[model samples]
Target: MSGRQAVPSVRGKPGWLRRLDPLTKGIWLLCTGLAVMLTLSLTAQLLWYLVVLILAGTGAGWRLKQWRLFALWAMGFGLPLLLFQWLMLPVGGDEPLWQPFGSGGPALTASALELSAALTLRSMTLFASSIVYATTTEPRDVVVALTQQLRMPDKLAYAAAVALRFVPLLLAEAEQIRRAERLRRLTPVRGVGGRLQSARRMALAIVRSALRHVQDVSTAMEAKRFGSARARTHWRRVAISPAGWLFAAASIGAAAATLVYF
Candidate 1:
């Protein structure tokens, strides 16, 4: 099979990043997420916001396709932050409006409420940024970067990449099955029982679909000489550019400064 054109890879650009290595982008996102969470000053949070701006401007914002997904995550992480701000901060001070609930006889001030609002925004922003990372990155790219650059074993890395590739495919298939189930007159749930029944159907569909896709992918990979130690070549290789290192260094430096200060 000398010079046989290999099966086209689902790697490289996703019609979005235009050949931007997913691994590079993933590391940058990781750094940004860590920095945002640790940053006490909202100004610092805003600075990292520029990274997201650049990503969007470059058309890589296709990862942000699932903005609605962020709402659920925002509730999970941001709600707690809001609750933290509410319980810890007093609602009154010089401009006291009401009294603290128990123990301390301090007045709850408007300033404390204002602080909560800011904290809420910070939490939501952090969560939203995280969603962008998960949505944008294709797992195979990450595995390649780790294996090729970090000297990790290709066998292990490829295993990880294959696993990631199946997640979204399974999700899509499960969604399809759910619709099919609905068409079978088992959907459009109105009561608690109906909802529970729908959930059960969806869960079963996901499991079955995932198993089938796994088998298909495994067979296809095996047929294609994947996991071979015969030195397969990449037609489209991931190259680390000078820009990548610069981005990484700046992210690390910025994150470090924030942690030390705030």
Candidate 2:
């Protein structure tokens, strides 16, 4: 990560979104994502994506940095799917909408283009919804909701919570490893082969470190008898007010209606 710059955290304005039940947000994202995937309708997907954006921007108080992150994520994850669908998906009897620059090969068709757009939109919609949910919800709240409201197994809930909490730690560890390598005068290799070798080395180091960390966590949990109790009491209770339910219902209903109309 030499020459890699530190990313500034873009803090959103404090809002009631932080107070919303994690379970409701989870359900909304799940329902909306599934609806988009099932409908595979370009219009519905686009609309859903826009709706999620508005929710994140207005309700969650998104700013320029968040929007930039959203765009970056879309390009990274959605663009490849779109390109592959357009280039490789078969289009029988459909008129060509585009032709590649060289070799005079099979041209792209309206059907293929439409399919590509649908796939891209579906993926982007899901990704955007996840970003909104994760940014707005807290990990502890999610774990509590899973265990208390959803009646998930205590061990499973704890594991999920720990995994979510590990994300930032793992990222920071990777950065530290990179910095250490740079301190030792190690840098990214220039050529494709060298880069691949460097990547392999880095990956192995990260994986080994992660495994050690996981082992330590497991030992610590076992020592603490984390799941020994038949029933555990939470220090903090999460209650979803009537208003929260109404908000969730409206969002889910809109998504379902979109699917039905499309």
Candidate 3:
């Protein structure tokens, strides 16, 4: 199988960022993530989105594909802003811009548009930042940084890594199985029978594949002497560079400025 797992080939430390520890990268991601989540300022949100969008091009190409998916997602989520602006405005405000209904309506003011823009930008930044971080950094590194630097529980970290790794594998495997089913069924179109039965088969296949993977990982771990008693070493090492430090500093500075100004 072209898709069969031999081993995961995660990229190594770039010459540019080999000096800083994983903890620093982790810290930068955390702080940026917090800013993405908590900030109400539009400028800060746009800055974070732009930084992460550029960073997305640096890593595995798979992560960049999420931008397409996120556009649809963000628009779907952002639609509520229009509704909120329509419903909540004109109730008490002096300035009114949009009147949706004849007379049973509220007014849409500039303030309402500003609030909507802020909320929408914040939501989009949060979504893009999350995808960028996940795509640029390996899940294992994230878990390791949490456990080693933040004193997160070892079991929790391990579980998180496994789950993240499992998602893409399962998705790929499901795609393969779906193709196989299509081939098996001699049809120009996917009928209800084909869709339902194929979905059921894919679910079972996913479960079996997951269980097998778990068993294999356990066996390999035991063979390598990994246990509750022994220290586990990661093959993929994540280190930050001077550029990463500058990036973090800029992100923090932006957040600070936004906080001070707002």
Candidate 4:
């Protein structure tokens, strides 16, 4: 089967971003992550995130549907972090924007707002870039590129591929477990303690399922004599196209510019 067929998560028609070799997309992700980490300016961080969104929209064919989940995730985590930084963190100016409880109870300030915004934007950028890479790149192609082009060990490369492929499966499985519980008329967990118990039970179930699947995969690999040979042959050959090279170079240049200018 083709690499694309092996992973159902990598759906949708191929686009410019999806056509690039896994190595090239990996490099782009790495560069984007590093650039976001090194960037301190809020404006620069926002620009980087916008550039990633544009790439996802134009190159990866991402639409409102694709962005909906991403937006939810970004806001779910970003807003809390932003508020935490602004309220709890002790890294802001003395001029209080809003003193909630008299003189000294988590007063908001301009510097706090700026710092929180930058940090939140940086996190959101990394999150969005990761989603783009994971959605566009195929797990089997990642294995091929790593083992063939990067000369990584076949065992290690396959492990990485399995990780990439199983994450979504595990998530779906957890959701299914939740739905099953709901269908059985299980009472919804109320407080923090009850929620933690429910979560713990769900995690245990997922872990057990994942372990069983891993055992099956291990058995199949052993039957095939995986990692027996010093040299490995890939079913699919992955090579960097000229466009991939250009994309890598452009990403590196942009990362450099972000580091230096911002």
Which candidate number maximizes TM-score?
A: 4
Model 2 lDDT per residue over 41-128, tens place? 7888788888887787676766564456457657867888898888988876787777785547867988888888988888788767
Candidate 3 C-alpha lDDT tens digits along 1-262: 3332211113322422223454555566667767766766666767777776565545434322344445555676777765675466444564677677755666766777766676667766665655444434566676767676677776678777776676556655765676677678776546888668766878999899889999997888679665465455556655556766786687677666666665
Q: Give stretches of model 2 more than 4 Å off.
A: 1-13, 61-66, 101-104, 167-209
Between prediction 1 and prediction 3, the one with superior TM-score is 3
Q: What stretches of model 3 exceed 4 Å from their correct place?
A: 1-25, 57-66, 80-92, 147-151, 166-227, 233-237
lDDT of each: 0.60, 0.74, 0.61, 0.81
lDDT (Cα, tens digit) per residue for candidate 1, span 140-196: 666767677776777777776776565445545654665577678843679988788
Best lDDT goes to which candidate?
4
Cα-based lDDT at residue 23, candidate 2: 84
Q: Model 3 reaches what TM-score against the true structure?
A: 0.61
- The clash count for each model shown is 5, 0, 2, 0
lDDT score, candidate 1, position 30: 75
